[model samples]
Target: MAVEVKNSESQAKKRAFLTPKRILIVVGVVLALGVVGAIALNQLSKNPAFCGTCHIIKPYYESWKNSNLLANKHAAQGVECLDCHHKSYLEKAQEGINYITGNYSEPLEKLTFTREQCLECHEEDYEQAVAATEFEESNPHDSHMGEIECTQCHQMHDKSKVMCSQCHTFSWFEELDDSWEIES
Candidate 1:
């Protein structure tokens, strides 16, 4: 009788230990999977190809193909999509939330770069772009004083500005396909 009771107690101890071991194995597997998934996602986001994988971004990519910035070669060489778009921690958080919620159809304005966003690198030009035309120009000031945001003249999405012909009496865009052909 005594021997049977001791063996029963030993079996109960083993059962208790097995439960914790199973729990630990499950937790470890879950953590490992999470790490692997995070690494894969980080790599995908870095690829420009990954950005264009979505159908919604096709227009943006096509616009970039025709942009002056693409012809610039210098700016295109250094600046990636992230350079202007993901400048702030808050912006990163916003992006994460958008991904988490699977809301890919947000307004283009929200995702598009603003004049303020580009100022991170173009610090010198920020004042000239935002400042009144009087103080900004070196030539004898003759034009009307219009305080314009960088985006006013230049379309932030394409990094292109209006043609001189758009405001003037010339049809420069008839043959020359410049970045911005003046929005109609």
Candidate 2:
């Protein structure tokens, strides 16, 4: 009977430590910490300085600094690095692992942006941009060439170019050059 009492006392003591209230408090603390840590990491990763940590990204950072491209303008306007360079957390984690292992590709492949991505922010000005560049021979934004990717001519961190010049000639090219230079 005494041994049974002792065992019961020990069990009660153990249960005291893991009472429902205590368990709830511990879980709440852990969840709060997890939320805070995730928020901190996300903010840190969104910083442009964070992107510059990789040596291969230096050229892009420098170009963003000097270029009159939309990316630079957006940066100046307080857009975060991740706003455009968004990746899933898993993808980002894998990339981080690859970078640490020196398994990433050399010459760091250029990041690509889709027209839809650009349109998200520029949708209001899409028509205006197209109209501004409209030429008698072709409406660069509304013609068959419109199907071409925005990145083909609209470099984000470098001098934008007219990819059409490689395959076609137009008098408007000179006008575009003059206007772009003036805008710069």
Candidate 3:
């Protein structure tokens, strides 16, 4: 009976060592980590630093710092870099392509903002601005630069909107048109 008991104990140990359950548990852990790693990699691309990695975006980073919209502490507090820039996975992918191809390069210019991009958060603001009867009549920016993109003037990170007077005094234009007079 003692010998029989010893043989049974050894058999039990061998079975436990090779069990399917143990193997499955180990595989599950590895697969879970792989899934998590993939997600992390995807998120990394959306980071503002990641966007700045491309030489094309470096200028945008600098200009955004000086913009009026970016300087607005209230907007900056609630809407972070990703909130305005990386709203969706599709946008992230598009950004990657844009960075590589240098497409839409001019929007990075100081005192500019992408109206479509800004409309995402300021939907009501955009609607009001667009629908206003003054949109055509008193739109100072439109008269000067044709139609301006909101993002072209507004920076996402710094949230600054460059005023016309920053570079060109109202008098400069007023010299050309009496209506360009400075307003108090």
Candidate 4:
């Protein structure tokens, strides 16, 4: 009877605690949880408010709230930060790491988008935008400067300035655009 008890105890000890089936189940559950967490984070971060959570974004976020800049107009038409930012996930991750490591510059640089990006919602193409605004005298879209950048005239966070105003003596304020001479 003593020999039988010792043999049974040894057999119990030899039995593996984590079988291959149990390992697979644990791995599957962890992967599922990770996927769900990632989805939740992505959805929550889509709102511009999420960008405002960071201290560095305070100025831009505040501008969006009360300022009558182009940003507010875009927001009114259902455009969000990510829509214009268009930064890749990897680039955004690196930006966060740089912020954490204090390896970034102050007075955050203004982000620029391609002409195609602007035309995405504003018009069908650059020519279309030009035609729409040609009713104005100067026709900023059809400039002699040859392919003027939209950002040069249409700032979102700061005051917008007409590029032509730099060279021509246009009677306008700092926040003026092509439609400065609207005949009321």
Question: Which prediction has more favorable TM-score, 1 or 3?
Answer: 1
Candidate 3, residues 38-156, lDDT tens digits: the string is 68868786565665577766655444444443433433455445555444756666766776677765546443446666666677866575555243234444546766776554444
Writing each residue's lDDT as its tens digit, candidate 1 over 44-160 gives 766655656656665555555445553233236655555554535455456667766777664354444455655676677555633533332221112343433455555634555
Q: Model 3: how far is 94 from its true place, Å? A: 14
Best by TM-score: 4
Q: Whole-model Cα lDDT per candidate?
A: 0.55, 0.75, 0.56, 0.73
lDDT of 2 by residue, 98-150 (tens): 88899877788878888899898888788898888777887767757547777
After superposition of all CA atoms, the RMSD between model 1 and the true structure is: 6.8
TM per candidate comes to 0.57, 0.67, 0.41, 0.70
Q: Any idea what lDDT model 3 has?
A: 0.56
By lDDT, the better pick of 3 and 4 is 4
For model 4, state the Cα shift of residue 147 in Å: 2.5
- What candidate 3 gets wrong by more than 4 Å, as runs, is 1-16, 32-77, 87-113, 127-139, 158-168, 171-184
If both were scored by lDDT, which would come out higher, candidate 1 or candidate 2? 2
Candidate 1 runs further than 4 Å off: 1-18, 65-75, 87-114, 124-143, 156-177
